[model samples]
Target chain A: MLDYKLLDALVAVIETGGFERAGSELGLSQSAVSQRIKLLEARLGQPVLVRSPVLQATPAGQRLLNHAQQVQLLERSLSRTIPALNADRTRLRIALNADSLATWWADAIGEFCREEGLLLDLVIEDQDIGLRRMRDGDVAACLCSSDTPVAGARCVRLGQMTYRALARPDYLRQHFPEGLTPAAFRDAPAIVFGPHDQLQHRFLAQQGYHGRFPFHLCPSSEGFVRLALAGMGYGMIPDHQSLGEVKAGRLADLAPGEGIAVDLYWHYWRHGGDFMERLTTTLTRKAQGCLTV
Target chain B: MLDYKLLDALVAVIETGGFERAGSELGLSQSAVSQRIKLLEARLGQPVLVRSPVLQATPAGQRLLNHAQQVQLLERSLSRTIPALNADRTRLRIALNADSLATWWADAIGEFCREEGLLLDLVIEDQDIGLRRMRDGDVAACLCSSDTPVAGARCVRLGQMTYRALARPDYLRQHFPEGLTPAAFRDAPAIVFGPHDQLQHRFLAQQGYHGRFPFHLCPSSEGFVRLALAGMGYGMIPDHQSLGEVKAGRLADLAPGEGIAVDLYWHYWRHGGDFMERLTTTLTRKAQGCLTV
Candidate 1:
């Protein structure tokens, strides 16, 4: 059996980003934490961490973290079933895309968390890349656009987020006076969410503009909307999020009839137990109400 | 002297994240891009990239990237001075925290960008850690909470963001009935922006509570506010961000008199030339109007 004490030391070190902080969090001396890591490496016959430049998990370390997270979830399931075993509330670490988190995620999970006495540790990532968190074993579950599940995990399709190329009326008037022609796209700037976000590029390509274009990259979902509202640039804004602005006539679709439907999926461990199952059910039902099916 | 062609290849590879994508962006074959990287590395007598799990720059590569970025900025300055030299617009990559971007940054920079015909490539990071992006040579500038500048960089104090522990009325009534006693805080869940966020920890410590308390880590600045407004948890929210919610009675301060003040700074390359200097002036002048000085 793997030594959980050693595994816990590894988890603490990775989570806190350093040995010193891990020691403080775990109530162990710095040297003691280092010794435990060494012992764990010796037992495994491989190095679990890379200590130079930055503390990161090696491939071996990631696998161990995945195992440790699964064990923690199972333990939490037991505690929940037998409330006398533990009085502390349960906390689940999840990797979620910023768009969902900004729009319907909180509402979807609020009542479930309150009723179950649960807390969340949410890691924000781009929907296109959130699954890497699942692969790296950093999060127990993730909400991403990828439908495929990682090894030892299961995925369920939740709903779809419909995104339209949207901008303020003035932005269209100033930049795309002739309306989204390839020639106009050459000079007009667009807004991209970030480096990993390809929505704008894809949207433009679909609109028959394949040339290089200038853009403003804004990472915050709310900030993305705000930038468009401020007449900075046209961008792909989800219908769920842009409803108020659209209704207020603050935003207009650059390409009125066209939109990209991104399907969202909930990826979690196959054996994540009763809590994960219940939470998934609640999320699916709530998300269905707000998102396009 | 380093060849500009080789340097461009290095920059494109790192910016696009792979030789394949870099090739597509630069209109070269993948092998041609690879040969350029090899030629660049041979000239430097070192490896430029680590190409295993992910394609990332080596320490030497980072230094080269910094040089390339400075050259690009200087070139842009020259182009601005002599419009006949280049008709292309200038783009500046910056790392900014979510709070500043959501609240005052866009408004602060919008007019300046439009007037200068510049585009922004924004990388969102925690204020406490944004300086690292400057060190890693990924951005031309950054807005962070750090007062100190990195090597070859200059920093200017912009202003301060004041944060208060705010929660919905029902949340306060249910969780902190006795009003912020250490015992009350032991179980009352708090919301933290992310792992790098220490405002909540500092606030709790200032109130004389040192025990491990439960917290929900919501990374999005707007999502953090939404979670708090949804009666999920109390979080330290900036006055700039929470003004509307407080005015609408959707949120209330847990401790009205006590709040944390985080100073914001603008860090840029010391020799980033005229564009950087003008942006620094505009940001400093506009931030003073909105932020506490």
Candidate 2:
């Protein structure tokens, strides 16, 4: 088994970007930190850090870093469960998309972390690709829209996040003065999440309008909504986001009852660590409460 | 020179995730798209797409995608500038952080995209590391804190984004009822952007307090501010985000005039694009107007 102290040093070095900053975090001298890493490399039979342009962990080092972080999370949960050993708030690193981070997941995560006395370390990326980070051990768990599980991980259905195809009343009036049609889709602009974000594209494909689509890409969950609100383009708006505007008729749901629902899944490491279950449970409970059943 | 049609087919295959989807985007049969990719690969003597559990571009493929996208962007700009040739709006992929997206950058980009009749495809990531995507040809340009230019990219100073360490009035009264101290930092929660995000830790280090610091991670720009407002933790709030709230004394700036100012830069490709200069100029002008120069 690899020495955890070595792994800790490796993680710190990669995270802080250098031995000096890592030394500061670990409360060790720069030479002391360097010695630990060297010792680690001696045992592992390979250099862990690449230090030319900038300091970063090698692929092997990243795996170790992710493992060490997982162990740290487990220890925190152990302390919480035992209620005897000195409780240490460990960092629980999780990956998620921008939309979920901005929506229901934020509060639910905060509440769980506070109660368990754990520190959260989130890795935000596109939902379709967020699982890739988890697979590479960049994060312990991930919240993704993909229902299909990767090998060595457990997937739990967190219910569907319904998205209504919405546009400002003025946008529909100006673009499709007659009504929505396949020809209108070619002319009118559409709001997309990002390049890799396939939600908007998939929605269009589901609508059976297969042609060259004009679209504007907006990054944030809120930013996309604002762009759609300004009548820049019609977009798939998450149903739970805003009730007031839709109810007030500020935005029109082009296809009522035809809301495209993306079923979300919480995928976590199947083995190792006690906190993953608790974290997963809390996220699922809170997510189900917020999402469409 | 590679056939633009084949390159377009390759790009569509990678971005849209599969041959069928790319076929739909390009208005061609799946076999036709596949044939184009095969022809391109035959000329290059390498496979571009990694067909497996997921569809993604090979390193060589990413380079070609970036080049083709750049060409498409330039052609669109040429059409706009010339006005005689019919212009087709193409996606202009750029990388930036979420904080900038939520703040003043969003509107500025929107205006520019509209004026140029171009589609915006933003690759959202942290400013410090977003430059990695630029180097990989994933984006035409990136808004980053790094002043050091990459080999082929030109960097322009966009001014400093000042961040005040702030919290809700009530959080201050409850946690550090006495005042700010080293002990208080150890106990009180602080909001962080993400795992790779070192802003909060760096702030604490600069404050001359180096110990095990407690922090809560919130990914989104607005989400973290909201959490800070909800008294979850004191965060480094970007100054331009809400001057009114700080002015009204709702969110207390824990350290006045001690705000951390991260200098921002616009780094882009030096050649093969006409609109990049315009985009960079508009961004720099708007950013300088809003940031602390």
Q: Please give the lDDT score at residue B132 for candidate 2.
A: 77
Question: lDDT tens string, model 1, B1-293?
Answer: 77989988987787666787788768999899999999999989999999754567887897787677678678778987897888446667788988988888877888788777787878787754567778877678999988877999999999999999999999999998888887889788888886556787789789987655667878888899889877899999999989889999999999988989999989998889987898899999988887999
Residue pair clashes in candidate 1: none
What is each predicted model's overall lDDT from 0 to 1? Answer: 0.83, 0.77
Stretches of model 2 off by over 4 angstroms after superposition: A50-56, A77-84, A125-138, A147-155, A229-231, A244-252, A269-274, B80-84, B127-138, B147-160, B195-198, B217-219, B226-231, B242-251, B269-274, B284-293
Q: Model 1, residue A153: what's the lDDT?
A: 89
Q: What value does DockQ give for candidate 2?
A: 0.43
Residue pairs with colliding backbones in model 2 are none
Docking class of 2: acceptable
Cα TM-score per model: 0.90, 0.87
Best by DockQ: 1
* Candidate 1 docking class: medium
- Interface RMSD for candidate 2 relative to the native interface: 3.0
- Shift in Å, residue B232, candidate 1: 2.0
